[model samples]
Target chain A: MTDLRKSDRLIKLGLLMIAFSAISALFVITLFIFEQGGPIMFKYGLKSFIFGQDWYPSEKIFGLWPMIVGSLMVTLGALIIGVPLGLATAIFLAEFSSRRLARILKPVIELLAGIPSVVYGFLGLMFLIPFIRENLGGPGLSVLAASIILGIMILPTVISISLDSIRAVPDCYREGSIALGATRWQTVRMVVLPAARSGILAAIILGMGRAIGETMAVIMVAGNAAEIPSSILQPVRTLTSNIALEMGYAAGEHRQALFATGVILFVIIMVLNTIANLTASRQGKR
Target chain B: MKETAIEVRNLNHFYNRHQSLKNINLEVYRHEILAIIGPAKSGKSTFLTCLNRMSDLIPGARVEGQILIDGQDIYRPEVDVVALRRKFGMVFATPIPLPMSIYENVVYGVRLAGKNNRPELDRLVEDSLEKAGLWNEVKDRLRISALKLSGGQQQRLCLARILALKPEYILLDEPTSGLDPISTMKIEDSLRRLKQNYTIILVTNNTKQAARVADRTAFFLMGELVEVAETEIIFTRPTDKRTEAYLEGKFG
Candidate 1:
């Protein structure tokens, strides 16, 4: 018994160390980004660094307002396109589909997440761009292209998590509603959706995080024009695209500015993640 | 002669190939409490669900029976199941309160039926809660989450939800099994009063509960109803030996 206990303690300690390593790595990376990014912000003045609408690294002018606006517009556009489609698909799978159909379709929907992000970007470049240029009168590579690609990319995250939360609702809630003469659609709209609201919100928040953090795909399709786009047809550069496009040639304060972009992205993701956690925890308590 | 609220003839139920109920024949009178007492796997709950066609929700669950509600054949292929369900509101053993405020929980059924008038909704909520004996406790806290209520209060809230529908028949499946004694007594008291307005079908594992609130009692075993008689007669001088043995705690 003592030998078993001793081995258990050793295993516990090893697992604890592994867990702490992941957390410590996060702390170190965040500290390093802030340490590298903080001086540049102070030198340029925080307001000017964030709000100035110009970007000329060679001229030592780094205003990230355009990129920030670009990121917000792209993320917002993705959500507008993704949320309704994802939620509807999730509802169909969780509530309406027969078991055999759900079995086949759910896995196929989840498989979308496994396909590489670059492949989606490539597909957008190949087909969506030309189609948009011909039909919508745009330069092919624009905020519209980026939004469509990111929306497709985030569908798996939204659909799977929303489906899971919808399924997690107890059958009794449905039974009670049905027993009271509610149709299937009525029951889902009233009881099941309300019961799963927090979880669905959390799923959407996580999907938002995914859309904003996506780099390779957005960089490929967003056209990387370092100016604030006035319309969906115009080209724009997100904070992520700004970093990925310029990091290879960047040195000195320009490199620090890239790290500063990382800092902003990290903070946004952390806030979204925190909100998701709160929603999930509240659901658990209920 | 008492009016028949519901009549079942040669009722048979199956889940895939396995039969859950066999040749169930019974009649529930209007404004009467009929207690169904049975051990586990006795098809009591299945019998109740079949009345409202709640079994339709379960995959591979099939029913072959003549269930007449108000002289209409409920099992007919063209019957609107939603309307049939509204006629017989059900309450399960476990209390399932919707994730909403107490007032909202009671009006959920009414709202689904597309009655959205505010004054009518307020009246219905108050009337239903009063009938369920839950009004005094929750009247002042109508906006609070129903989940914040005690287990017993939650169960009453479920009862209020059904009451808001104004169902002709109320089907209860071991509603008091999870409740404490005081809560059970409160439910029993409300059930006795409710029989004045609606017919009730109660399935219970506790014989004492059956004796307390039942006007008539039916005994079932292994998907078969052994005997059904007046509540007092069934308890004291049962006709069937199986019923006698079950009452004496000989075997389930």
Candidate 2:
């Protein structure tokens, strides 16, 4: 018994060490990014660094307002294109389809997520860009192309999570609604959807995170033009694209500015994740 | 003896070929409480669900029967299931207060039926809650979450939810199996009052409950109903040997 207790204690300590190591790594990375980027923001002045549009690194004009707008536009476009299709697919998989069909479709949809980001970028560049150019009358590589690619990339994430949440609703709610004379569609709309509301909202926020943080695919189709786009057809640049494009040759304050962009992306993701957590916890309490 | 509210003839039910309810026939009279008592897996719940066609929700559950409510076949292909369900409301063993307020829970059925006038809904909510014996306790907090109520109150709220539909027939499956004795008696009292206006069919594990509130009682065993008779006759002078054995607690 003593031997067993000693071994258990050693194993418990080892696991605790591993857990804290992972958490401390996150803290270290956060500290490093802020440290590297903080001085640059101060030297450039916070307003000029964030809101100035000109991004000519050679001239030391580091205004990133256009990239901020670009990120927002692309993310919004992805949601507009992805949410309806993803939610419909989730509802079909969870509520309407046979178990055999859902079993077949769910894994195939999840397989889309395993395809490398570069592969998606290549496909978007080769096919979608040209298609958009021919049909919509802008440069082939434009905000529209990036948004479409990112939207497709996030479909698996949105559908799988939403499907899980929708399926999590208890059968009692459905039975109760149906027993009260509500049709199947009416039951789904009035009862199941409300019960699964928080989870679905969390899924959408997660998808938004994916859309905002995606780098390679957005870069390939987004033209990487440092300008605020006036329409969906125009070329644009995102913060992720900005870092990826300039990080290789950047030195001195230029490198620090790239780190500052990473800091901003990190903060955005943290905020999204916090909201997702709160939504999930509120659902748990209910 | 009285006008039949429901008649089941030559009924059988199967879940993926494992028969759960064998050939059974029963009749429920208007404005009468018919209690079905049996051990677990005796098909009492299945028989109750069949009356209102709630069994249709279970995938792979196949039923072949003629269940006539007011002499109209409920399982007919062209029957309007929604309309049929509106006429026959069901409450399950577990209390499922929709994740909404108390007032909303009572008016949920009425709203689905397209009655949206606020004053009309207010009156219906009060009447239903009172019929369920919950209005006096929850009248001031009708806007609060139904889930925040005690287990007994939640169960009564579920009863109110069904009452709001003003159904002609009310089917309850072990409605008090999860409740304390006081709560059970409160529901029994409500059922006694409710019987004046609606036909009630109760499936329960408690034999004494059947004795206390049921006008007639049916005994079931292993997917077959052994006998059904007046509650007094079934308790004191059961005719079937199996029903006698069950009432004596000799074997399940």
Candidate achieving the largest DockQ: 1
Clash list (residue pairs), candidate 1: none
Candidate 2 lDDT: 0.91
Docking class of predicted structure 1: medium
What is residue A94's positional error in candidate 2, in angstroms? Answer: 1.5
Considering only chain B, report the TM-score of each candidate against the true chain B. Answer: 0.98, 0.98
- Residue B40 in model 1: lDDT: 87
Candidate 2 C-alpha lDDT tens digits along A54-148: 99888888988999889988998998888888998999989889999999999999999999999999999899998999998889888899989
After superposition, the stretches of candidate 2 with alpha carbons farther than 4 Å from their true spots are A1-5, A275-286
Residue-wise lDDT of candidate 2 within B1-252, one digit each (tens)? 599888989899999979988889998899999999989999999998787788888889999989988788889999888898898878889988888899998998899989999999999999999999999999999998888998889989989998999999899999999999999999999999999999999999999999999999999898898999999999999999889888888876
